[model samples]
Target: MREALIVWGGWPGHEPEQCAAIVAGMLRDEGFQVHLDNSTRAFASPQLSTMSLVVPIFTMSKIEKDEVSNLSKAVREGTGLAGFHGGMGDAFRDAVEYQFMCGGQWVAHPGNIIDYRVTVTRPDDPVMQGIGDFDYHSEQYYMHVDPSNEVLATTTFSGEHAPWIKGVVMPVVWKRRHGQGRVFYSSLGHVAKEFDVPQMRTILRRGMVWAARE
Candidate 1:
């Protein structure tokens, strides 16, 4: 069976633990042997490279240089990486290398919790197939993204909260690669309950599976 390691912990505001549980269950349902850890130290495990996938649920946390290095090396060597929201996007703020692997960083959520729309930009991609544009009620993440990322979904800023970005199209979901690894991310699921949203959950599910090492 494919194995997946999930490391969760950081700012409680994002309910990292709760979100991790939801993701763990999702992976288990998909036939993956899931392992969960509440500390970033798990990233340093020698076995990390053997796993099929790594999911980081840490938001705004500090990671040791060695831990980040090991995590990056594992992914670069072919272990897949997938995650959503601040857990992956806002994690390891001081680790620029980690940010580069993630393909984007969550810089702002203009109006905090508010309603927005998520538009599918790559419906033909396996991760987004059959998913249509949907209304989302959460932080419309304004991110600093990698230009090389294969953007799969996007959202337009209305300038209501951050006027300078009015009408600017921001990537909400994307998939990219780091060496032999597949990396996927989505700026949805501010909390565990967001998993109840079919679109959000389905997108995350498909993205995770798509990122797993074959």
Candidate 2:
């Protein structure tokens, strides 16, 4: 069975624990030997090097240099890393190395929680296969993404909330490589309940599977 690690905790408002539980359940259902941790120290575990995938649900938290280094090394050596929303995107804001590995960083969410549409940009990609443009009522993330990322889904700002960003297309889902590892991220799922949306749930599930190293 593939091994996976879920390290959660940072911002309680994002419900990191709850969101991690939902993803953990999905990973288990997919035959992963899921290990759950409530601390970032888990990233330093020897087992992490052997993990097929690592899901970091830590948002707006600080990570020690060694801890971040260990995680980076593991992913660089082919341990896949997958996460979503501010948990991964906005995590360790001061750690450029961490952000570099993620391929993007959450910059702002205009209009906070608002109605928006997610467009499927690469429907042919396996990570987005069977998914279609869907309606979402959540924070429309405006991220600073790497140009090299392969964006699979996007959203356009309506300018209703933020005038200057009106009509700006932002990536909603993307996959990239960090060294030999696969990295996948989605600017969705502000909370665990958001996964109840079929499209969000499916994309997250498939993305995790795709990011897992063989």
Q: In terms of TM-score, how similar is model 2 to the real structure?
A: 0.98
* Deviation from native of the Cα of residue 184 in model 2, angstroms: 0.3
User: In model 1, which runs have C-alpha deviations exceeding 4 angstroms?
Assistant: none
Model 1 gets an lDDT of 0.95
Task: Kindly list the per-residue Cα lDDT of model 2 for residues 1-214, writing each as its tens digit.
Answer: 8999999999999999899889999999999999999988998877788999999999998999989999999999999999999999999999999999999999889889999999999989988888889899999999999999999999999999779999999999999999999999999999988999999999999999999998
Give one clash count per candidate, in the order shown.
Answer: 0, 0
TM-score of 1: 0.99
Weakest lDDT window of 10 consecutive positions for candidate 2: 40-49
Q: Which pairs of residues have clashing backbones in candidate 1? A: none
Per-residue lDDT, model 1, residue 83, is 97
Clash list (residue pairs), candidate 2: none
